[model samples]
Structures are given as C-alpha cells and as structure tokens.
Target: MKKNLWIGGEYQSASSYMELKNPFNLEILAHIGIANQGDVLSAIKAAEDAKDIMTEMPAFERAEILEKVAQYLKDDREECARLIALEAAKPLKAAKSEVDRTIMTYTFAAHEARRIHGETVPMDAAPGGQGRLAFTIREPIGVIAAITPFNFPMNLVAHKVGPAIAAGNSVVLKPASQTPLSAYKIADYFHAAGLPAGALNVITGSGSKIGDILMKDDRIKMITFTGSPEVGRYIRENSGLKRVTLELGSNSALIVDEGVQIANVIPRIVNGAFAYQGQVCISIQRIYVHEKVFEAFVEKFVSETHKLKAGNPLEEDIDISAMITRGDVQRTKDWVEEAIKNGAELKAGGHSEEGIFQPTVLVNVASSEKVSCEEVFAPVVHINSFRHFDDAINLVNDSKYGLQAGIFTNDIHKALQAAKKLHVGGVMINEIPTFRVDQMPYGGVKMSGMGREGIKYAVEEMTELKLISFKTE
Candidate 1:
C-alpha cells in the first residue's frame, strides 16, 4: 500500500517509514509515512491558518461541510470498515459499528455547528457585572493537536475531530502508530467534501518522538489526547499553557443486579468483553454481580463465552482476533499468570502467545488481584459477588477508573440509586459497560481522564466562550 503524510490538503512522503501489520495472522499490510519535527511544524502551521479562516466562515457553511463529510463516510462505508478491521484488529461487526458511530457523531456535530448560538445575558437583570450585555458566544480555539489511540480508531478520531471542526478549530491529527490509515481516510473525506485547504492534517509516527514535539509546539493551541494514563500525565505536564483534553485509561466496571435476568444479559456482556479482543477502554474489565444471581450468571456466562469463535478478524464468525502483537499476547499472559498466582482462579480460556489469546475468565478473583485492580485490555473478565446493592455499589466505587458501568435491574428505584452513586461518566441500565451512543456524553471520572467526547458536550469542552458586544450609545 502507498502511504503518505496528509499535510495541507495533500499527501507528502518521507524516505523514513513505519511498518503496519495485521495483528490477526501477522501479515504486513503496508508501510506508513513516519513524520519528523519539520513535517509536524508544517502541519501545525496549516492548521493554524485554517483556524483563522474557520472563525469567520458562516456558521451555516461550516455545518454544511460537516454534513457533507458525514455523507461521504456513509457513501464509503464498506471501504472504511474493512480498513478499520485490517489496520486496527477489530472484528468485522465491531469495525462496521465504529464506522456507523463515526457517521453519527459527525452528523450530530454538523447539526450542532449551525446551532452554536450565544445566549443573551440580560445585563439589566444581572447585578453590576452587566450593561456589558455579556452574551456568551462559542469561539473556536485556534489549533488542535489530536493524538488518538489504537482501539476504535475511527470513532475516537471522530470524537476529537468532529468537536474541533464543529467549534471551528483547525486540527492536526496523529493516529496511533499501530493504527494510522483510517485517520488519513477521514482527512481525505473532509478535503473531498470541500473543507478549506488548511482545515485538517494527518501525520503519523513514533509517539515518544512526535507526540512530545506536538504537545510542546507553541503554535498548537489545544492538545486532545486519548491513550494510557502515563502518557496522558506526560502530555499535561509538558504542554505548557495550552488547553488540554485527555481521555485516558479505564478499568471499567459492570454491575449485575439481583433483579435483571442473568441469561438475558450474559450475551451482551460477553460480546463487550471479547469484542475487538478486548482492546477498548470502555470494555468491561471488572464485573460485580449480586450474590443472589452471581453463580447462575457465571454458569451461563462461561458457557456462552466458549461459543465465541476466536481467530483471524477478516474471517467470518470470529469473535476475538489476535491482539495487536505477539508481545501483547505475551504481556497479557504474564498478567493473567500473576493474577492466578495471587489467588484468582482461572475459569475459562487463559491460553496466550503466538499472537493469539483465548477469551479468559477469572472467578473468586481477589479485590486486590492485578486482574481486578488494573486495566486488563485482554478478553479476561474478573467476577466479584456482592450480597446487597449498596455493597455492590461500594465495590464498583472502590476502583480508580470509572469510564462507565452497567446496572441490570428492573427496579427503577434501585437503578436510579445505582446510577446516582456509580460515580462514572455513564450508567447503562439493562446493558453492559460497552454501551455507548454517539450523541451521549462519553467520558470518565477521577483518574480515567478529563472532559467528554460525545458530539454536543465535546463541542462545549473543545471551544471557548467569548462574549462580544457593540455599544448602542
């Protein structure tokens, strides 16, 4: 495959390159353009210029461009989904779903762009700070440096780019080293749909090198990142005086209440845990089940999990594929072993290495076990049983990562109670923690990260409100 850097509405190539592989079956897919400092600066400059024009562009025109981009994606659905699966190691169904979500998020952002109205502050009604007629109007921050993660490559890019574009900010996108092409595809669509030359740029390379340079660049006004907590912290510490939005790691939780039927819920939960080989940040890493239904749920859950066909992502009926690399398999194996040794019993599918890992489940897992406490991106599920609703809520709250949770109870009172007390970004009733709608506000609490990603809320978080007025003297 011919891969090149997309800078300023065009493709540029360098002699240096990075090799991209299909994690499933370990085949080389293509060589990607590896960007250096010079390329990064040029992309930043282009985006800065785009931001300057974007602010003055009619809001209706901006919204039309966003809508056109969404249409372009929908028109090219099959191509995009296939690329997502091959490059990002996502299963076909989930890969297609990512494309679906990207279309939805972009469309929502398009509609929102036109509605970026400022509310009139009745200065007369407010106390002294008035006469200013301080109506808050949303203004696009200058330029954004968006660094996305491997999992949900297309959707995560949409999460950042959609909001930035909606708020009229120019953006320079850096896809994960492992997953790059899909993002370039997004930039191509925006350009094809008649976006201004400097509106969006895509550059891909080593995170340790290009990531820091992008963050430290003075021209880049905002840095929006989605990755590990360690890297998130590094970006915040180094990106001096710039606005930052970090969607970091999550060892998300799912609570199975005593009321929701166990058999009815396990399939969706298993799909969430094993989908995309469990690479998603919002996947169910820890599951807390009420004591009344704990063992029953486990019985059905394990049986259903065995039926999950695990193999090449390109092949049909394969639920889980090989992880991103053989090293990923090795590390996951080691973590599983550590958890097993630390008194967590392996319930199902613990084999790993050779770039393939079986969907694993561990029960009677200690609260302190690494599998339970840490973010295991593998298809392993840690099950802990609680006798009461309050106890289960407490157990879920104990963890530091709180991206999302699922409460499977029919009782509205209990569900509402759990939702209020869950302390996470989202609460899903009658669903697994993997449930996410493109329009919903998606983010986490505590160490997981800052800010939200779903379209409307993200636009609010991505831009600044500057109230301007003309004196009617």
Candidate 2:
C-alpha cells in the first residue's frame, strides 16, 4: 500500500518514501511519504493560514465537527484497530481498546469544545475602582504542532489533535514514523467531518529531519509532544518562546503492601508491566513489595506472566508482541543482562523467542542498575522487598521520573500517605500505575515532562487567556 502526506487538506506525494513494516512479522505494510523541510514549511504555512478560520468558528460548530469525527471513527473502528495492530504490533484487543479510547477522547473534546469558557474576575475585590467589571476569555493559541509516539498512535494523536481543534486552533501533526497510517486515517475522518482545509496537516517522516522545523517555526504557537525525555528536552530548549506540553518518559513503580489479596492483584500487575510489551509511558517498571509478602507476590506475578500468550498481534488471543524496533529488543536484552550481571536474580522470562522478548521479572536488583533506575520501556520489571511502607514510598520517589505510581494497600492511612509522599503526578491505591481514563488529567513531573493531557486540560493548554475589563459609568 502507498500512503501520501496529508498537507493542506490534500494527499500530496513527496520526493521520497519510507517503508512501514509490521514489527511482529516484518511484513511490509505501506510506503509512507517522507516529509522534507519544504513539506514541513508547507504544512506550517497551511496551518497558519487556517488559524483565523478555526479561531473565528463558533463553539457549537467546532463541537459539531468533533462529533462528526467521532462518529466516523466509530463507523470504521475495526479497520482502524487492525491498522494499529499491524503498524505498532499492539495486541488486537489492546488496539481495539485504543480505538475505543480514541473515540472517547474525541467525544470528550467535543463536549469540551462547547464549554471552553473563562471566569469573570472580581475587579472590586482586587482593590480596583468600585464601578469596574472584569472578565477573561480563552482564545486559540493558533498553529499547534502535535508530535505523537508509536504507542497508542491513534489515541495519543487524538489526545493532542482533538483538543487543539476543539479549542479553535489549527494543528500540524507529526505522528511517529512507525505508526503514521493511523494519523492519516484520522485526518481523513476530520476531512469528511467538514473541517476546513489546512486546519489539520499531517507530516510523516523522520523526526530528526522535520522536527526542528516544527519546533523553531515562530508561526506555530504551541508544541505538544509525547516522547522521550531526550527529545522533550531538545524541543523545550530550542523552541524559543513557543508554548510546549510534553508527555515524556517514565519508570513507573507500584508498591504491594502486606495483607493484601496477592492473587487478585497479580493479574493486574502482569497486565500493567507487560501490556503492549510495556511500551506505555506509565507501564509499571518497578514493584516494591513489603517483606512480609515478597515471596508470594513474586511467585504469583511470575506465574501469571508465564501464562501470557506472546505472538503475532493480529491473533485475537495474543497478549504480547514484538517491540517497535530491533534496536529496542536488543536494548531490552542488554538491560536485562546488565541487571542480572549485577547480582539480580531473573526469576522468569530472561530470553527472547521469535524476536519478541518474554515478560521478564527480576528480584534483588540494585536500585542503580539500568533496568531499575532508567525507563526500561520494555516488558522487564524488577521486584524488591521493603520492610516498611515508608521505605517503599522512598524507593518509588528515589527515581528522577515522577510520572505516576500505585500502591496496593487496604489501609486508608497508608494509601493516603502514599498519595502524599509518592512525589509523582498521580497515585493509585489498590491499582496499577497504568490505570488512566480519557477524561482524567494525565501528565508527569520532573523529567517526566510538563503539562496535563486530558481533554479538558489539553484544551486549556491549546488556548490562551485574555482579560477584558470595562468601567461602569
């Protein structure tokens, strides 16, 4: 199949193309057009030109367009899921879930579109002259650049694009090269929904080639990206004064306290650690179990991990699949080897079969090892024992990342304590760090990146606040 870049509301061919393959089987999926510097500039120009049309559009009209896109996606959900599975090698069930979430994201954006209002400020209360009225209104930030990742290509793109459009801002999307087809399809949906030409432009290709163009362009008012901390930092430093919302990497942790139901939490933990081969930014990479329940937790977690079916993602029963690239697979192997070499015990799944790494678990891993300290971004997790609940919280907080963490505890005080002391963006009691709904504010702190990404929060980021004051006679 041949795919062209979606720029200026049309399918335009580029001078070159890159082959997109199914990561699991190496099957060629499509020849995706590679956007060059000129292409990126054209996309930005298109977005800049359409800024006024989008900003001047009424709130209800924007909501209507978003609703139509949601309906269109719902109609073609199955094909969309298949595309995601083929491109990202995500399991069919997980891909379907992503599609559902994408729909929900757009639906939420539609709802938020109509309710994007600012509050009236009390001028008198601020020591202003008595007869003054003050209020604020939100306005689009104009030409936004959305750079999404390979994981959850559709939904992550929706998280950025849906809100940007809903807030009356034009978007220039740069989906991950590994998963650009889904973005193209979404652009098609927006087109069919009667979005104005040039309002949404998709440039597909190498990030190194086109990313700087988007970041440095003064016309683009905001840059919303979801990727690694390295790239996030690069964008932040080089983008000059542009508004940025980065959803970066994380080494999410979970704490399992004593006296909790071990069997009940094991499956959820397995799913959290290994789902999509642990590509999720919030995938649980570390587990600090209370010493009292360490052995039982590890045994049950490994048993559940062993039962996971790993193979072609297109198969409905498959639970895991290949990582996005061969380099990632090798990196995962290296990290696991390094951890084991440092005296960590690999309790289960230390090898790869058919290019797919097994769900790996390690115990006694030192906190300084790469697997434990860094964002593994693979299906490998380390288990450690902590004697006290405070120790577990300290261990979870010791990392440079502050994305999200979870604790399995029946004690309300302990849960609340974890919530207060985890030092992350969010804390989940009796739940995995992977727990996230479409409408909740989701982002990280510290190196995990800045800003929130729920539909409402994202709309707020995509817009600028303007204060208007009037003097009463």
* Candidate 2 residue lDDT tens string, 1-473: 88998999999999999999889989899999999899999999999999999989999999999999989888998999999999999999999999999999999999999999999888787555568888999999999999999999999999999999999999999999999999999999999999999999999998977889987789988999999999999999999999999999999999999999999889999999999999999999999999999998898988899999999999999998999998899999999998898899999888887679999999999999999889999999999999988889899999999999999999999998998888888898889999999999999999999999999999999999999999995
- Candidate 2 structure lDDT: 0.93
Per-residue CA lDDT of candidate 1, range 1-473, in tens?
A: 86999998899996688789888766888999999989988898888877778888887787888899889889999889899889877888778888998999889988889887778776667555544655688888889899999998888998999888888889999999888989988888889888899889999898888888888888888898999989988988998999888888778788888877788778889888888888888888888888888889888999999999876676656788878878878888888898898888888988974577899999878778777778888888888898888988888888888888887888899888987899888888878888888888888888788888788888887778887765443
* Candidate 1 accuracy as lDDT: 0.85
CA RMSD of all predictions: 1.6, 0.8
Going through the candidates in order, what is the number of backbone clashes in each?
Answer: 0, 0
**Pairs of colliding residues, candidate 1:** none
lDDT of 2 at 58: 97
At residue 414, what lDDT does model 2 achieve? Answer: 98
Error of 1 at 405 (Å): 1.3
lDDT (CA) per prediction: 0.85, 0.93
